[model samples]
Target: MELKTVTAIIGIAWASVITTSAQKITMYSTTPTERWIEKKYSPDKSPVDQADIQVYTDSLLQDVIGFGGTFNELGWDALQCLSAEERDKVMASLFTENGTLFTLGRTPVGASDYAFGYYSYNDVKDDYTMRNFSIDRDRYILIPYIKEALKFRPDLKLWASPWTPPAWMKVNEHYSQKSSGIEGTDIGHNQLDPNRNVLGNVTGFKMQQGYLQAYALYFSKYIQAYRKNGVNIQMIMPQNEIAWTPCWPSCTWRPEDLAIFVTQYLGPQFEKDSIDTEIWVGTVNYPNPDYIRTFLKQKNAEKYVKGVGVQWTGMRALPTVHKEYPSYRYMQTENQCGNAENDWSALENTWKAVVHCFNNGVNSYMYWNMVLNETCKSAWDWAQNTLVIVDRNTRQVRYTDEYYLMKHLSRFVQPGSQMLRASDKENVLAFRNQDGKTVIVIYNPKEQEYSYNIKAGNKNFKVTLQAKSINTLVL
Candidate 1:
């Protein structure tokens, strides 16, 4: 979408009262102590600073796909602790226009580490044709969670990725690649032989033709089954963290092997089955550019691969990969999970990540765990940060600093908004929505409040940012 430039009368007096008919700038600020406080300001007549952050709306970049969080089994399980009304309120806060207005969502195909336990749609051994595939297990947890979100925003776009393929398809024949030594988790939780914990240049999934073909069918059946259940998956990533060997549900695949799976089996099967869901290579956690290049350089990769899903260490490789394949879409698939701190520092880091991705050319950014129990402990014993924390004992919900940080962007930056070019200022982002409103987000990372002069076209305004706070200005 092209951004319409605003032509206005120049030399407007500073400190003039904004008439009702005139455009008024609204500012939303969130600090460590306060959250989402609103204020109003008129155009400043103050002299423009030489260091003013300039937003070029006419010089538009990528169109925003949207912003969202993942839907996990444990998130649903945590909500079960609340009353029906409370649960609905939480859903509304996430999916409703009155709240964050998240337009995108992600779901795991089978199980992520956040699931109550490890499982797959088809656990039947050697079901090469995927005849035994079923999504019945999701009916109890994931389906209901997603249905509630759809209740608020039926048009929410969703995508899916699996933490691991079915255990039967992997060479180790285990759901978890290795056992996490955390208390209460050990060899019993994971059956993979200790000696088989090889990492680099390994293909966890069996490289046989039957297993490859069946895995492809497994993906097809998953899409069809979810569609039958009222949830439409718009895209699919072949794997999550293709190079990581975490103790949770995970699979490692050499880039070349994955490229072959996409070109020979998964891509062809999707075509024969008439599945319109896009195929993306992703949830990549590796930082090596060569790792991604190996897959993209494969013959016919451009034909099937729609985009790249990057996160964690993979963010380091985004600039090089994006520059090389400028036409392919890119997304920040997962936000880095902190060590369950959920403090101001963590929120600041997350803000930096959001700014980095949007600045680097990602169309969309996704948060990891949207809501978790107060303990914030995963089934694999990993504690991670979340936007909201539900206290099982008290049935209380606490919105974290990160939640407001997301709201500072997602609440105002509508889907299809064009990312506006902004000066290379640290902790600043600008976007022009389809409605022609420009939203500017800035972060004050210091202990002292900072003042910024924002120049957007003929309009020049000054905003006072609170200490250690996030601010969004909507014009």
Candidate 2:
């Protein structure tokens, strides 16, 4: 989506009030004391514990692209159980301008650990022509959820990642990996085969001549298929996590092979087919500096890659990657899914993650799953966090504190806003919106109340941040 359209959509959605000459400052917070409370601040003076914020016009970072959550199978399944009225309410809360109004979406290209069973669109053997490719599974659940979200904002941008390509494409011919704990799988010492140079758990596609072309075509065909279904996917990645060998849907690729497929096949295919969908280089995890540097140093690295996507352990190398590849767009693709047991600390870590991702060079931030059943458990037997949880027995949909954390920023922060220079103290971030509004998000992880000052643009204010709070102030 273009910035002009983004500004128009968000402007109508945000309903930013203009004062002709002066700017308006509004505060929205998700703290222990208050929920999604909105407070209008007097920019000229301080009402409470306001601080002096200093703004340096010359120092700026990447422009804010957008915010959203993943459209996982589990999330869709949970939504399917919601009553019509409740479902509409949930959609509005996420997609409407008056609610979270998220603009970006992450989708699984095939299956993830979230799916009930392993699956791929082109499961047929020797189907290099991709005649068997179909998104029929998505139609039953995931599509409906995405389309419903589109009802509120048709321009919602989406990107997809594949957890496993296809059994026929991989060396192991296994749609999923045999992790140590999965039941009824071949039992043995699962370890990386150094001699063969393949992951023993779940080897990725055989890096052969014909397979590479077919796989690239698989992606292109998928894009065309979605467009035929009236959905436009804006970006795509080849794999979910290049380094993991999990129990469920997964494919592990050597860094060299991944880079080769992108530069030689996927990149050129997208261009040849005239597909507008961008090729982002991640959803990759566990960043080994040498691992990522290997890909970046490839011949067509600059030509094929539009951005880098990171999650979990990938955040460790985010600074180095951002510093080295300053020209490429960077995104925090997956917000770390906290333990299913939702608590104050989970919310705290989530808040810190948002700051951490943006404070680095991430232009966009995406949560893993939007909603799950009460347990927030995945098909892989592990549990995770989401914006909301639903109870199957009573058909009750309950919003979590994390939902409010998203509202704190997505509710007011506009796309195209630029992250401004701020302190590296780990909890505070400031941004300048395209509409000229200044936004400040402060997260206090401590248990005690603390007061601080944010002085910017020659205006000073004093404020007291509550303990264990997630706060966002818009000026």
Candidate 3:
């Protein structure tokens, strides 16, 4: 027989043996304008080159807990702009089991950077007893948002972190690191307690002398109070970003401070109170593995910290911690805030961010804001991206590209989904859900459509990827 005839015969045999679209796989995608747009395509059963992307079904990596976003004051304000029916509709989109079914949430312990104003649970000076601790602001704002979310998903889990300790607990007399410079508040000291109409004589600095115990008690009180209010907070991070020092309400803590507190103060205090909440040494934004290493060196450090929560630069330390300590669970505590464009470009960045985090052993991914209004403005004059945007003037809710980005992951990848260690030539991550289905997310960053290949178990298929699109393939 001629060589050409022999080659054609081999190709026909390969096509017959390969898995085709008849195998019944689903393709869901997101474009610049569309969110969770479903498409149908059959896998090519022909002989393909090795250059096509190959996903190995047997190579499982991590078990994903879930995907979610923050419940901040800014997000609350944006949510309130909509009518009650519209509000429920939006909440259902994010929290309901029929929707994204996001089971995890990130909440600020008191006042986060995106808080409406600077305040703490116990701002009163010399209030060591914490008799004045109250979540009145939360009742009016953050609680209502959380309560509404609970209506959609009663199983939502929350982890609380503080941007700073109470004003009297930090270095010198304030919660913020630098001066707001608006009169009484300065780098050296905060002038007075406006709520009490009294000057802040409660002095002496950052978790010093007797302040560590008091501040730890403050966290305990906040957790207890939230529990009393029907909010089941499951975890607590001693600090938001131990390395960050901003003019806003923030505190800069050394590695030892984190170690000493978690191992010595925070951990023991929670135990004494019999609080089931786990302590997390986060939402650590620092990238240095050394800081995490330093904390781990403390006696019984692992006893207190059940997980590591990282965001932004903290990603650098994540894989390292996971590599060294696989026993501890890891999470992307916060997604990087974008420029509030809420466009395809920003969503692409989010795609890369989630991929990177999951590839590095982060089991859960959390976005910064679920919704922000037209301004997308922060309390400190900054703007960041969000999943939904509300137009106050029109009272309209617009889902952004990032919303689809979240949808692509949340819709298909459920809690307890085991990520597959799929080798990627096509910028993809594959995972197997609890139901024994295979899911591969392909992110095409190129300017043109690219044809990719997948090899799962003994079956092989070919996929055509569009330019700059996120495609989820489920088998």
Candidate 4:
């Protein structure tokens, strides 16, 4: 499919007048040539066709936690390239009530693939006492980025997870699991000696008591330090992608070993320190259901885990895992990061991902890389897509198609909204806010414009959707 215009139609229907033709509805559309153009329409007095979509307001599902994106070091550095006023505008568009109103955010505990370089909170070898543990490095980049967002929305919920543990705490004694260069490049991504022990199928983290105990202390200190800095990290995932052994700052974990660590060390440490941060099992990137089961099936680990986070291939495991563990909260940890194209195809994939996760019972959804420089390349030489891009030379900021796609839902779907049942046709999603406002988001992929007859509660209305566009109707 070609990258075409996306038109969003927002309608407000009153409960009293919903069944009458006198009900006035407003429409707002975004096209490639024009963005968020407003028009007016009224309920059809006489209809010739059956309802194309049926919304069941009585059938409510998960309560939305909210929408958000990650705060990466590169994203922050990209914003630094823009003028102060431009930077503020971008921040406002992301977090302010007048904008997308993102209420949740994810931050890396230490170095992620997007970081300027590989490092950790405590690099001192075998510091079992954790006396050297400090977030002094975060003060330079991550902390400021998080603090700025808090300025716009102080209650913005934050979660954190590390790409890898400190080098000394790992069996490989390196920040990365791989000893070789990235697949397509000759550049070695880390300083791991090629002759030394490279992490294999085993858990990269040392399973000994001393390492496990100190690592748990690492997590507690992280939470305490962030709280001291006025940024309350509400959640912490044990690791980011336990199955993948990437050349970047990464660590692989056997599910059984992770279960043991969380059960005996991480969980008990948090309880001992009186830290209120919730522990979650994720951001799982593997497709195998056994990885999740190996963790959650352990009753002790399940006791401390409040939720599960899934991303990439892990999405395939979400259905099975969620089916078995329905009571646990679920989240789409990271949206698939495309190849920095930021094109319509990527937007379509994002929409499909959003639908799949919400339909499968995720309470919250998160996008990766909120912003990036024009090059879109990470410090480790990997290129990825982002919602906003800044041109370093021109000092210009541009919001990609994904940004508007996110706004179509996040701007209308408030935090307390409940997911309402809607017919599976036409890529439709329905939600009802706490204030009794109903929101229907639909996408028309056909080349020809189609008119849809919608049934909500006892009321019925018709909306004509644009060709190859996404529409949001609010009532």
For model 3, the stretches where C-alpha displacement exceeds 4 angstroms are: 1-22, 43-51, 180-205
- Candidate 4, lDDT over the whole model: 0.85
- Candidates 1 and 2, the one with greater TM-score: 1
TM-score of 2: 0.88
Give per-residue CA lDDT, model 2, range 333-450, as digits (tens): 8888877756666777877778778877889888887888987877666788888888887888877888888877776666878888875437777778777777777777778877
lDDT of 3 by residue, 174-256 (tens): 66655443234343233434342211222123656477788778888888888888898898888887776555666767777
TM-score of each: 0.94, 0.88, 0.88, 0.93
Candidate with the greatest lDDT versus the true structure: 1
Candidate 2 at residue 442, lDDT?
78
Better of 1 and 3 by lDDT: 1
lDDT, candidate 3, equals: 0.78
* RMSD of candidates 1 onward, in order: 4.9, 7.7, 6.9, 7.9
- Measured by TM-score, the strongest candidate is 1
Q: Which ten residues in a row have the lowest lDDT in candidate 1?
A: 2-11
Put the candidates in TM-score order, highest first. Answer: 1, 4, 3, 2
Of candidate 3, the 10-residue stretch with the lowest lDDT total is 196-205
For 1-475, candidate 1 gives per-residue lDDT tens digits of 3233222222233324344236679999999999899999887655586746888878899899889999999999999989899999998889887778898899998999899888999999999988888899898889989999999999999999999999999988887676554435452366657876747469899999999999999999999899999999999999998888877788999989999999999999999999999999997888988888889999999999999999899998888998899898999999999889998988988988888888888999999999999999887778999999999999889999988888888988877799998995478899998688999998888899888888887678888899998988998
Clashing pairs in 3: 53-453, 59-421
Relative to the true structure, how large is the alpha-carbon lDDT of every model? 0.88, 0.78, 0.78, 0.85
